[model samples]
Target: MPDNEETLVDVRSLHHRLVRINRVLRLAGSGSGLSAGTAAALWSITQHAPLRLSRLAEIESVSTPAISRIVTSLESMGYVERRADPDDARARLLYPTDAGRDVMSTARNARVLRLAEALDRLEPADRDMVERAFEVLSDALVPPEA
Candidate 1:
């Protein structure tokens, strides 16, 4: 087995490569006319709809004001809606609209297609190794419930 130092170096290298890959994918898939922040906000809302603004901010690790602005822009674009929170009359819950889901879906598909094309260029064994590596990493990040 590799030593801890060797594993750390490999992990750091993988992290840097993944970051670059994500940036390229984002640029290639940014046809929805949304900034990265806005797109991420929309995706987050879709995943956890009916979320409070403050909660969304916490989940996204952004300030409430930042989330508020993004929500406002999405609302104005008809991609998201603010509905009254039944539990709190003064509070509003954010939900993604059909348009928002469509936009996110399209953007995700574009990015995946671009990635698929790149992966297709790799040797089958190399591609298989990449796929298995991702599976292992994903399992490590979020292990299945016992």
Candidate 2:
């Protein structure tokens, strides 16, 4: 078994690699023509719709003001819209318009195509190894059955 220090090093390396992969994929998908922040914020809003600005900020790990700016940009693009929060008159909820979903779909397809191109270059054995590794990682990341 690996020592604690070895385990830490492995985990840190994995984190950095994942971050780099995300960065590369973000750059690859240009169909939306959105800044990274705006794209991420829009994707999150779609995943969890009727989201509040505060909640979006929390999810994005950004200050409310910063997220507000991204949302404003999205609004200008006609990708997102703000509506009154019936439960709280003081707050507004964010929803992705039809255009936003279309943008996301285009972006997603571009990123996947990029990844597939890279995967296609791998040797059969190497590709199998990647698939097995992903399965292990996926299982490890999931919570145990209740």
Candidate 3:
């Protein structure tokens, strides 16, 4: 078991990482239709291929109204479309429109470019470690069920 000092240091390091990631995400997501949670929603929609509104709300761990508001915002921006669910006429499914897909593609490219620029000065080994670390972090944040 780690000592108290070691545990505190580890916690502080994790908090710092979270804060930095949040700040970067806020910067990356600003002026875009996709914040971190919304981006996760979009990503899930793509992966699941026409997920329902209630399901999406559950996945995002937000209220139905919150998902509705996000979807409404996306719909207004022409990034997402809601169609009646075939299985359940009472429910609506969400999917990305072509414009929405374009938005995702452009944002992905921007993130690549931004991270690439930041990594330019790093040692190659450090950069590779960062890449691996991102994979681990992504896996932790988005579980298999999620």
Candidate 4:
């Protein structure tokens, strides 16, 4: 069995490598003309449409003001819109625009293609291991509520 310290080191190394891969994928799909944070916020809106700004901030784990700024950018880009909340007249809910969906779809495809190319360069056994590892990591990281 791996010692705790060795496992921790492996985890840290994996985290750094994943971060670098994510950065590369983000850049590869950056033709959508959105900043990383703004694109992430838009993706969140797409996933949970008609959500309140506070709820979005909570999901993104960012300050309300930070989310507000991201939303402002998305709104200006015609990627998202705010509609008055029916239950609460004082609040507005965010939804992705049709254009936003198209852009996000294209961006996702680009990122997937880029990742696929990288994976194709690996040996067959290594590729299989990477796929299984991702499944394990996903199960470990994402809770049932998430």
Which pairs clash in model 3? Answer: none
TM-score of 3: 0.76
Give the TM-score comparing model 4 with the true structure, all chains together: 0.89
lDDT of 3: 0.78
Look at candidate 2 and tell me the lDDT of residue 120: 99
Using TM-score as the yardstick, the better of models 3 and 4 is 4
Instruction: Show where candidate 1 strays beyond 4 Å.
Output: 1-8, 143-146
RMSD, one per candidate, in order: 2.4, 2.6, 3.4, 2.5
lDDT of 4 by residue, 30-60 (tens): 9998888888999999999989999999999
Q: Candidate 4: list runs displaced more than 4 Å.
A: 1-4, 143-146
Local error of candidate 1 at residue 114 (angstroms): 0.7
Residue 120, model 3: lDDT of 94
**Number of the top candidate by TM-score?**
4
Return the number of clashes found in candidate 3: 0
Number of the top candidate by lDDT? 1
Query: Candidate 1: lDDT of 45?
Result: 98
CA displacement after TM-score superposition, residue 59 of candidate 2 (Å): 1.1
* Per-prediction TM-score: 0.88, 0.82, 0.76, 0.89
Model-by-model lDDT, in order?
0.95, 0.92, 0.78, 0.94
Give the poorly placed runs of model 3, Cα more than 4 Å off.
Answer: 1-5, 29-40, 135-146
Whole-model lDDT for model 4 versus the true structure?
Answer: 0.94
Compute the lDDT for candidate 2.
0.92
